[model samples]
Target: MGHEYAFDWLDQMVHELDPQRTEPERLDNYQSIAIVEKAASEKKRLILLFKQFVFREQKTRQIRNSVNHYLSAAVSLMKIANNNLNQIPTKANNFRLALESVFSCLSEVSAFIVNRYRSHVDRDISLNLVNITPDAHDLRTLGNRDAMKSNLKLSKLVTEAFSDIFSDHRGGEITMRKLDYWVSVSHAVTYPNGLLEMTTPFEQLELIMIERNFNSPLFVKYLVSKFSEGIANSEDPSSRVQALTFLQKTFNQIPVMKDIIFNNQFEDLTLTINSWFIQEINFHSERSGTVFSDLGEQTQKASKKYERKTSDKVLCNLTVDQLSIFFKAADLSNIISARSLSAIFQSVAPYLSTPHRTDISHSSLRVKSYSVEERDKSLLIDIMTRLTEQIRDL
Candidate 1:
């Protein structure tokens, strides 16, 4: 197919020249102008053909090959036109038109190709279709619901087909690259709806929590309890793990909720503890505590004195080991009811065995600089051993 297009282009160029003429200069200039014009026109025609095929319902492979062939020919013609411009030294409108045509053709072809491919790529390919149909009783009462089901089913099939096609690359190698393109396209198409759907899950979860009239601590407890039940009932290990992780994350959000309620005084403390614990457990720091600082700063006018005092104490007094206590406490018991201040103290005992460095030199009161270093390590180990023993007994 490409070969045929290239041959046609070459034939057009050959027929554009004059072989016999008396005036050598006139003939030479005329031949150069004719060739430039012919190449330009051919390039323009190819561009038009590409546009038509791309827009029309036709075989993807055939359209792709034809477009590629025309594009190649157009590029070659552009080079020839440029070369002829220097050789002829004439202000021929044909060469200019040809060059402009090449530019226009390439622009249109590139845009059309990119847009067509991009239209299909989207993240919603992974999302399941949510049917929005009303109940059968309501539909029967309304008397206008049958069409709605048909439309919804059609939408589901289309979305599923698109996902399956992109997943498997049924269209061959070309479609593989088009997957990324379609991803972008899908993002654009479904972004608005995605944002709406996002609110729904959180809202549903919140509504369930709100019905209990629970504070942050109690809310977290409820979530953990429900999550544990969900995990126990779940047969799939992956689902269980996901549910557990989600519950832990939900519990972790308690400190943030508390900060919001208390006007952000101890937010930094919460974040700092979270960061250190994540680093210890996951071997990676999640993110910095800057957001806590930002929240404090935002509410500084109203809570300046409170914020200053709490920030100073949290930032200066708390050690990494102390923070680890909070994290361990967060995971003490499977049932939320089993977790209390006592449980927190119990969780902290193990970490306390590995006492952090304590320097009293900076204390406001002029206290004796006694070295507790001798007992710190041994004391920490003893506490940890006791905690372990207690946990085993339980």
Candidate 2:
């Protein structure tokens, strides 16, 4: 609506270009050709501005103009095609293709805006994010949960708009460090050396960077600090699971203090985890949640209704030889002579499958070893019984 002259020109231009609105010779009409050429020239300039906007440049006015330009171009092109993309004639096939290219570009830009942009405005009034200042409290509380409604209503306008733009194309070659990129983007949006320049709180900036790159060392140290702080504030057990799982998986990935921090500190780590969680035991502690001291047997049951099929998450850790032994035992109606188990397996080896029959050995003094967990409570308890002795020997 602000670009009334542009809008009026577009409506008149599209109307004149419509074959139904003019004579059969409309394609050859000098005036029609001139209008199309003028639109083409204007579209070219708008495209340059649109590209800059997509690249996270803060050309607000030009972006608005280009957005309107796309709208105008799309409407006119559809009218010329009579809503048929495939039936576009050779007389103006070039124009049709150009319109399609612009529309496709606009789709990606619009999708980026939808997926990321949080408008920093109220009642269509600009908040000018760089000028608004936050105190220590805001920085401390950032990302603890969702952003405050009013702050999100008008905060980090530039960051929000362009964060996805950075994330969406992160696979491309990057000339700067990941943290450097965010800092540069902040400068690009909020501190362009004119108007009002301000800085994002270092704490908030670090939090944002951590969220973007979850495997960052800063995040790992922050988690280690939070979990080791002698208390857990949140009631969510997933936090505990996440912290412990990530630490266990990426212990060596944390750079300088891997061995000093985690190699011989299992006792301390377990104690810290217990301090935070032993009493609470997750939200299942609430009476409203279901509890079954014993679910008894999991009897096989058929599906009663339509449900999405999901892959079974069961983890198989047994060797093929063990499975073959189990199969033989099952086939023998669960009869097992401890002395003859290995001999029986060796005898049956030739009749079994290739991998399954590879080897069989009897061990009277077998050492139990479990290096991976398969989400079994009883199995975990059995493994825990051995962990202390194993660590003591280490």
What TM-scores do the predictions have? 0.25, 0.23
Q: Please provide, for model 2 over 157-253, each residue's C-alpha lDDT reduced to its tens digit, 9 standing for 90 to 100.
A: 3233333324343223211122233443344223223211122221333333322333323334454564445225535544544444343333323
Least accurate 10 contiguous residues by lDDT in model 2: 296-305
**lDDT scores of the candidates, listed in order:** 0.36, 0.35
- What value does the lDDT take at residue 106 in candidate 2? 34
* Residue 23 error, candidate 1, Å: 19
